[model samples]
Target: MHRRTFLQSAAAVSGLLPLAARPSFAGLYQAAAVATGDLDAVRGDGRPVTLPASAIKDLAASLRGPVLLASSPGYETARRVLNPSIDRRPALIVQPTGTADVRRAVSFASAHGLLLAVKCGGHSFSGMSTCDKGMQIDLSNMRGVRVDPKARRAYVEGGTLLGLVDHEAAAHGMVTPLGTVSHTGVGGLTTGGGFGRLARKFGLAVDNVVGVDVVTADGSVRRGDPTENPDLYWGVRGGGGNFGIVTNFEFQLHPFSGTVTGGEVVFPIDRARDLLRVYAEWSQKAPDEVYVDFVMSQPPGGKGGIALLHVCYCGDNADRDLAVLRTLGTPMANTIKVQRYVDFQKSGDYTDARTMGEYMKSGFTTGISEKLISGIIDGFEPHPARSTGVFTQHSGGAIGRPPVGTCAFPHRHAQHALMAAVSWKVGDDGAPHMAWAKKYWATIEPLTSGFYINEVNDESRAVLNANYRENFPRMVAVKKQYDPTNLFRLNANVQPA
Candidate 1:
């Protein structure tokens, strides 16, 4: 898709699409090809407490696949995340090659009374995908994508990263909207509410889903869709990793094509209020064909601030199309280049991919009002010297409106979303950023009540409950039906029956 078309589709998703029109996922979901790991070779015998080697032994023996106990050296390597602060200890780590192994692992965890946590790209701010001590089900190895071009659909594994999906889907001239960072796990983000550069045009990642392969607490695999186990399917869309472990996800793809012009445009931080006002006004009436996320970031050495705006044009009119910016302000640097959709997904991680640092985060207001803008301006004047401040980007043509009941994801038609994040070196400085993050957020919350579920930290308990609101109740009911014993209690929990 050229820049113009991409913008048009995005505009439809975020603004023009009817909420109730979400396609019903009524098809049967299939698991991956069965490998040697499909069979359960042994029975489990262990408890969450008493560290018994027998339980570990049984878990290993029962799996036709490989299982790594925490004591094993390999466990350390697989458990590491990009955030150094997220240090978790697991009793056992299982890498299931296929669904059968996942089933076995779930059953073992339930019967043996072991805590269960599932990891995708492991980008969760609160570390929901991993726990301090538990049974870790790492799906990072399940790299598979099957695209049906004629059907305009794709079946993606739970562990698949956005980068991989963007690369694969873009190849087909079809795309599924995903998060900003390509390294983010599609499962973790989609299971919550996925908003990507394409969101303004396409809708939530959950909105695009056709069906999902879910393993209930009973360890029995079933496809959740409108015609089969419909209730579970409803809950998984925006309900989070609560109902059960998702093995595969089927998505309805948007017609996407070739290179488009998209990327960063930085302006002096002093122009934040002006840019913010422009965003707020434009966001309300913006077409689905445009997606532009706004960011307020403090660069290194704390000189001043930057209005880091990320823009994507789905239409072929990059030349005459992007003159919209002149309405905003004089850009210090606007280097809009035409690049492949896959390359666009890789923009953020290019400088920091596979990098580790200490990070603290919170969420708040959509567009900064005069009051909030003043507070932000004041706050940026003197950030903790060792740390950098960031206000996450939120805006795009297609990201604005969806009915509340369309799916479990409730954040539709909301004006804006913002994340307050601070990243610093591990031992060098963690306290100042944490303190600043807390102070800044405390003031930011009065202006806004909603926040992104996937970008939270330790204090997000009450905030997340409020953020998703009524979706939680329905999620609980669905969780009861699929996992009565709460076997899949780890990660962003969906309470069981």
Candidate 2:
């Protein structure tokens, strides 16, 4: 039986059917005390989970940056990550000023038997960057970007957001390919093989990685690149933060002049069949300079989904290239035009002003077959909520040519990736939204070849093994060498052998 079907059947048999059937409450966030477990929150190995007040004070004194406890001024804001679904309450939020501060935080967590999580842009979909009654080493204060125009390179601090990198790279008429959102942290994105508008032409963010300054589980500072500590370099390219806390990244930049002809064409649901058919045929042979995606979303105040064709062309003939995409179908709206790359990047950020609950599951596809297109259309029509939909991120071009086994990111040959996102208000019963996402995922999962570790929520050993595929053993070796005790078990963990 299909994996999702079996899981759903099992849940039904166990009285968990219709996930939205749980008792409902009306509130913006999870109950406050629920997040703050009783003073004793630590589990496993029977160690004392509670730390003395004096020890927290001492640790605060050691940090050059501020240490925020639950009572501090910015404690609430500091502890919150991007996803509202993750309402973890860490005991202390440590804002590290530099590599030294990061090292100190790691050492303190290890010595005191504290659960440690590393927070960069706080965009982790799995909420692995924060833990209950632990220390969240926030890199928000370390954002800094230095550009070497002559060498066509850039060095970005770990906590730096992709927006900052975009602005700085634009100053030099260059760019280091990153994700769609501007606020996403550079550390997590690059480490997980970042993909964005320029990726089809310039390659993934990891493909541009030249080096990294990292603080490992042992609190030792080290540098990894193509030469020195090559294995470490390989692991960090696609290995989530299981090995260490990356302090900074050196990237090779590409010239783009900060302008791209890109935008979206939206058509009513009636045109989906024709739109998807054309999109699948043309996108397969699209040039490296062109990036396009097929999206199905609920129109504002509308009953069903509208088909959207998103376009970005880096070549000179923007008008000529985009005109071909406009032929996808009769459109309800067409906004494709030449615009600043930075502005285009921000346009893709989540539209919700308040933090809303989010759940996502993504996988890679080798081609957009007719069955896949039909499944996508079927999945979006009866969306559980207006905030939920299925979309494809076109992937090819430079992404397909990376030297095999050069780095840990091995989904090089995938033609595109599909991500199913479900969103709802915090107070609502999340069962329906989660169930909707799972059912949609099940519809398309069989069409996919592999998964994108960054977009998935499943942490089961079986899922992790499948996500990494042939690269799993190598990642395990690296995990054993750097973190035998699983000090960084908060991510798509690659436990030591």
lDDT by residue (tens digit), candidate 1, 1-497 = 11111122122112232212211112101011112232222212223355355555566666655676544445675676556567777656787777888999888777766677888887776666766556788886676898888998889998898888888787888899888777788888898878777777787788888899998778889899888889988888887777788899999888888576787677887787777667666555656666766676653355555665678777866666567676666688886788887887776653222232445454535555678766655665334343344454454345446667777877664556666666554455567667777887777768765666666566545555566677777776777888777666655555553
Query: CA shift at 147, candidate 2, in angstroms?
Result: 0.5
Top TM-score prediction, candidate number: 2
State the weakest 10-residue window (summed lDDT) of model 2. 1-10
Per-residue lDDT tens digits of candidate 2, residues 300-368?
234545667888888997766666764554577788888999998887554322245667788898888
Each model's C-alpha lDDT? 0.66, 0.76
lDDT of candidate 1 vs native? 0.66
